[model samples]
Target: MFKKLVVGTLATGIVLTGGIGSASASTEGVENTKQVAPIAQKIKLETNYSSTNNQYGFTYTWDSNRQVYKTYDFYRHDGVFASYFESEGIKWYFKGKVRDLPGGGALGHYEGKK
Candidate 1:
């Protein structure tokens, strides 16, 4: 009976320890997502017309201090639109669309991470 009690206690302790570790990992993941959301939200691109290709495109760079992305250039093209920028030893790229906004300006969507 004593041996059985010891084995059961050990098993329960192991399971509880694992559960605590998993909870901690989950919390860390949530915090990371929260941090990344703001960075991603700050990305913006300005629209430009390319007379050559007759398509619209945009270019931008990441501003770490201001937490905003600055547009550098834009052009029109076919196929997927892509642009590259480097910040703090990390290389990032933006890939998405450039479309006309009903009111006036142009809108772009790009995704990248550093």
Candidate 2:
């Protein structure tokens, strides 16, 4: 019957379109993983230093093999106030506040990728 044939054709179209959409989405995820994989897997801290005054300082370095740049900043009143890095078409950021404790100490909380 024409109705049966039409129903079958519509079902076939829907299935084909769904399959194509899923395939494309999977491919896109793979591409994104590849783009960010280098930085996520290979980045490492190279050097870190603090200021003599302890008010402000920073660590700077790069992953030579992966070509990722990284830096971490330190603050006397605010421990590890901010951090930033980028590589392989991806960028990462971290920021928080920390209070310097009494008697030359620090007390605070921070959260982010380090």
Candidate 3:
């Protein structure tokens, strides 16, 4: 479990490094709300754009089923924007901590676009 978490974290970090920074530049519109506790959300996700492993493009179509998959830890640093993922019939974004585990899945805390 620890190994998986570590690997997942590293992978996610790589994904976010270039893609996320270049995507939005800064978490401009996103609020750094660290108060909300992350909830499990197994959102049905689809690729929004084609991205390779290390060279990632953080864009995806996600369902709003708030069950949890892993975590959005990678998204926390730069903060993800609506262009990154779409959910709940509206564009979605995240600026808090999140994570993804092997069997359990992703656990994320997101803030919808205002």
What's the CA error at residue 84 for candidate 3, in Å? 2.2
Cα lDDT for residue 49, model 2?
32
lDDT of 2 by residue, 1-114 (tens): 999999999889879888645655445345456554434566565553322212223343454444544443333453433355443343545544445666664433322222
Among all windows of ten consecutive residues in candidate 3, which has the lowest summed lDDT? 49-58
Off by over 4 Å in 3: 1-83, 99-104
lDDT of 1 by residue, 1-114 (tens): 999999999889879887545655445445456554334466455443222112333455555554555443443333334477554443445545467545554444543344
Q: Rate the local accuracy (lDDT) of all candidates.
A: 0.50, 0.46, 0.46
**RMSD for each model, in Å, please?**
14.9, 13.9, 28.0
Give the C-alpha miss distance for residue 95 in model 3, angstroms. 1.9
Candidate number that wins on lDDT, 1 or 2: 1
Model 2 has an lDDT value of 0.46
Q: What is the per-residue lDDT of model 3 for residues 1-114, given as tens digits with 9 covering 90 to 100?
A: 999999999889879776555665555676864468789998676433222223222333233454232223333233333334554343345544456546554444543331
Better of 1 and 3 by TM-score: 1
Per-model clash counts, in order, read 2, 0, 19
